[model samples]
Target: MMRSNAAILVCVLAGSFVMAQEPDTKTLFKEFGRSVKSDDITLSFVLLNNRTVDVLFQAPGKYAVRARANQSTTFYVQGMPEKDMVVDTKFFVEQDGHTYEASSLNIKNFDGNTVTKGTRVDGMIQLGTKLDLTHPFTVRGSHGSVEFVLSPEALKLAEPAPAAAPPPE
Candidate 1:
């Protein structure tokens, strides 16, 4: 009788495992990318390590990204500032044919001269902006690919900034 019970338990556990492994990366990203183009795109989800965060260009130089998390759960808000400089810098969307210069962005508490020291060996960009919850971003790095997701709302929060300069002669 005991042997029979043990076999039943093993089968049950195996069935549950099969059910757990759902949503392959390719399928997940395809759905996520489509949502971004929707009129109302508000999302909040977590990701695990080594997952692929791929962004396919929809328009000329315009990109739509589907970033998968690496081994942890991170938050996303549209227009919100990115905490990890290297990860945040990756999203340099070139709109309207003008190459947006990174140097032109003035973030609070950031000394432009010292910013380079903070660049990750993998080339993460440092960005400072008002914490706009409406535009929250989630791009976590793990394994080879970092997952990137954009929030639908337009989140906002003020950042510390440098003092304005005096008029030149």
Candidate 2:
């Protein structure tokens, strides 16, 4: 009985993925992505939520940094170094007069030896503070920072999905 129930649950989850009819999946992310030039690096950020963001690093060339989490879930960046650069900085966000920092950062994929260029890593920082997207926010790093003011379209985006719990009054 338990096995059959689990199977049904899996089917329901799988069906959600298969049921996505929107060809432009990027629409969900378009509202949360933004970029700026910070010193030599052109940093971009995508806000997945208050605590989550994706970051990207690019060099002299133009690259589309998709918003999802890896640091673009990670935001996107342009102007990565000509050669590979080491990931040596921390990331943070300043919102509503508070500064929140990244608990962990994964970059320069850790190989057996040194980190390789374009190496991907995963580490998310979630704190007790809930993100209030109504106000403008900033993503800061050792390199520089990016400021983002949510747009009117973001009103719907600001609200959590229906399944999420209600915010504290």
43-141: candidate 2 lDDT, tens digit per residue: 445555422221223433112222233122234333343235554346677888888865443343321233344444332333335456678878777
How high is the lDDT of residue 159 in model 2? Answer: 48
Alpha carbon RMSD to native, model 2: 11.0
**TM-score of each model, in listed order:** 0.22, 0.51
Worst 10 residues of 1 by lDDT: 153-162
Q: Which segments of model 2 are wrong by more than 4 Å?
A: 1-24, 37-43, 49-81, 105-128, 163-169
Candidate number with greatest TM-score:
2
Span of ten consecutive residues with least summed lDDT in model 2:
61-70
TM-score of 1: 0.22
Off-target runs (Cα >4 Å) in candidate 1 are 1-5, 8-18, 33-50, 53-169
